[model samples]
Target: MAQAKTTLRTTAAAKAASKAPTNATADKLVGTLRDTMVSLVRRDGPDLSARQLAVFLTCYLQEEGHTVRGLAAELNVSKPAITRALDRLGELDLARRKVDPLDRRSVLVQRTLKGAAYLREIRSIMGETSTVAKKETETRVVRATRRAA
Candidate 1:
């Protein structure tokens, strides 16, 4: 009997090792993500999955208006998938869907005040993460210098 072949894939760390200038820098980037996520979860806020967050970010960050079809094409996801994400976002008051005046058949995705506030909060958390990482790196450098003396 012939056995099926299993494909092996290289890990993100392995790929980063080849492209990143330093392991410390790559580690810091990952640490920043972890810390930011932790901060977000600890707050009184909605916890969104990666896909939902991507959809949210795309709507807020991009100035151009979005539609279910447009977002699906832009994010390389299915229209139904985008609709589901939007449903969650609407429940959170982060986004709203509206009937396009020009095209009644299409639904436009709109940004909400709550969504803007959430984005601001995210920015603050990421900034804090960067600051903490910088302080850690500086402390390491100082320790290394002291040990050399």
Candidate 2:
């Protein structure tokens, strides 16, 4: 009975130890996203709305073949909403709409150089923010361990 209890405790400890890194990673990701957004607003000043940001990210992060209809379906928004977002993106020159050669009715979303540059900047900001967050977390852990000891 004692052996069984020890084994169960060990298993629980292992699971908890495994989950600690995953939780830390998720926290860092959230922090990085927040920091990147603040940096983008402060530096670029496009002041993108939530829907606009969502649309922009979907276009840049996902594979090609993005169309108005496809984006609407993917985002669970109306076609007009997608169109409006596209219009805003167009105004910023971040994205352009091109009529599909195969289907004239379908409008394809294309990335621009400006948009690519913006994405690259965001990636850099995210990486830097994540690294900072990780260091802070490690420092906090070290402090806590010292306190415990």
Say which candidate scores most in lDDT.
1
- Measured against the true structure, the TM-scores of the candidates, in listed sequence, are 0.82, 0.82
lDDT of 1: 0.92
lDDT of 1 by residue, 28-138 (tens): 889999999899888888999888999999999999999999999999999999999999999999999999999999999999999999999999999999998999889
**Cα lDDT of all candidates, in order?**
0.92, 0.91
List candidate 1 stretches off by more than 4 Å: 1-23
Worst 10 residues of 2 by lDDT: 40-49
User: How would you encode candidate 2's per-residue C-alpha lDDT over 1-149 as one tens digit per residue?
Assistant: 99999999999999999999899778778888899889888884577888998999999999877999999999999999999999999999999999999999999999999889878877898888888888898899999999999
> Highest TM-score among the candidates is held by which one?
2
